[model samples]
Target: MEVGQVLHMNAGTGETSYSNNSHLQKKVISMTLPIIEEAMTNLYSSTSPSSLVIADLGCSSGHNSLFVVSELIKIVEKLRQKSGHQSPEIQVLLNDLPGNDFNTMFKSLPSFQKNLSSQLEAKDAGPYFFSGVPGSFYGRLFMKKSLHFLHSSYCLHWLSQVPEQIENNKTNIYIASTSPPNVLKAYYSQFQRDFSTFLKCRAEEMITGGRMVLTFIGRKSEDPTNKEAPNSMWELLAMALNDMVSKGVIREEQMDSFNIPVYTPSLSEVKSELLEEGSFSIDRLEFSEISSSTYYNEYNHSDVSEIAANSIRAVAEPLLVNHFGDGIIEEVICRYKEILLGHISQEIIPGITNLIISVTKK
Candidate 1:
């Protein structure tokens, strides 16, 4: 059986998590991939056979994998055709959490391999390879000079571990747990550690001129001094949880146990970090509001319900099931959805998101 199942939510009736927002995903991909492809073409001269390896870190199961994989293969084929070189031995790696549904990812591989092989065979191009490397992206995964191009979409910003302070607390003392000073500091420190690790790994894994294109959620400001407001998304999420607690859908004590497993980096912060690592040069940085048209936005009964349900399945439901207990998930999700539906809209979405930062190795 596939490790993951297709979303059965009907969008109109249930809650939605942000991950199931297909419109958001598509918009981010469209804005980022072109710049990445352009950079790859410029960095790698197509005149000669080049061994190329491309990796997608934090590639979760289901639709995310499907879209990213298709994009990677398409760009690689384009590069090969444009360069008129024998296709390099292609290596694509997908990394994610241990609990991530690799079964769904594996099931999709056969078709991908068959199709790519047939295309390469038709063109008499060199062989292509596909593999899944399952693990956290906070550490190294390859040998020196092993990669030609690297990409990570919507994943790098997550800290390796939730802050110990928040995790250790028995009561809900933090105003907004996700952005607690201690938590943010811990997440930033982890970002520093993991990012440095990423650069060190890439320096060893990438050729001198290899390219890397990364897209992740980023804050617009460089200021660590900014305070989160009550209307902030993080706070809104806190409100939703509070409502669930009041309804007895979830334990009030569990609130402290639930923190978003992510940290949003600012542009200045990213640039400073990249330079510190000295592994790559910034090529382009793009940021924009994701379009809602890419989603099932008709707001009709069935579509809305489906989208909402999928959202819960994609993020909230899974996290609750993992952290709190599966037994309370359905009821918790029901209450959480009620809170979210009251606040979350395609508009008024807090946080400046969809950051695409492209860099080339020195």
Candidate 2:
């Protein structure tokens, strides 16, 4: 599948929309707040730009988008207060793929602006500008030296597209223990290329000494196919698809042809890419574990599988529909939910890792 065109979260404010089902992503953003604060503080301390330009790459439609912007505004306000100067004219850019639900995002802006005005009234912070830039971050999306601080949460793991050569190797939807060496190599090569391009683009867009805080799914193990890492989620998802294939809900060939355009890279992989890119210095890198249960605390239901299925469906349903057609979406999700429910246990479900990295432009 062409990921940039087809890979978007479920749209609108419906039950399965990303806006409704993004608590897990919100948790990730919350975890990275300290890193974000530190980066912005360091940036302001060093340069103290009178007009701070910030961008939130892959900013999906939701409260999380505003949450990031609001936090950065607060940080800048505090910095200005400490320096005894007026807060900078903050320009916030929210970016995502072209197919993102920008309309819904725009609709939410009036309230966001009103709330922001109220919050800044006492501090005398300047009016911040917010706009949506709809496009892929895998390529250039902004003018050179336009951005000061960049933040992306739960986004970088998605590849620009599935590897072209792996069309026939359909044993799984993602890197798995059963995947062959060529399959692993293909995924790694794609990640290396895509991440290098991402860094290069950002380097061109950011001013010298600009800071970035990125958090996404990643693996703790060196092996790409390690079951203890995040690949286990895909393994379970693959099983769900396989069960459907056996029941004739989807073709075996279709299952083989489909693969998720995502990779949970190891810390070493990230460090090596940044080193090779030669435009950024790593300030901090951390890995943390979060339970699947953590994402569903707001829900009244106790079934972990139901929660897990909903979470995955919100992000994966659009892509699945693109590959398997609309008829099979509900059935596939239902089967996947059943499979996950059967496997839910007290072991904290393996293969879920979170990576947080902070860097500065050289």
- Reference-based lDDT, each prediction: 0.61, 0.86
Mind giving the per-residue lDDT tens digits that candidate 1 earns over 1-362?
11122111122222343334545555577677678778667766632336667787777765556566566666666777876666666677776666666676688778866775665433655466677886666666776777777878777765665545656433332223334466557657767777777777777877777778888877665643243221144454456567767777677667767665556777777777888988788888767654333343457534444455455455545555556677876655555455545544434334335668888778
Q: Taking the tens digit of each residue's C-alpha lDDT, what string does model 2 give over 1-362?
A: 67889988888888888988897789888988999999999999999788989999998897777899988998888888888877789898999998999888889999987897777645567768888898999999999999999999999999998986886567699887778788899999999999999999999999999999999999888998888635777777788888889988889899999999998899999999999999999999889887655654455443667767777988998988898899988888888777666666444466468989999999
| Top lDDT hit | 2
- RMSD (Å) of each candidate, 1 decimal: 5.4, 1.7
Q: Which candidate is the best by TM-score?
A: 2
Stretches of candidate 2 off by over 4 Å are 121-123, 293-302, 346-348
Q: Would you give me the overall lDDT of model 1?
A: 0.61
- TM-score between candidate 2 and the true structure: 0.96
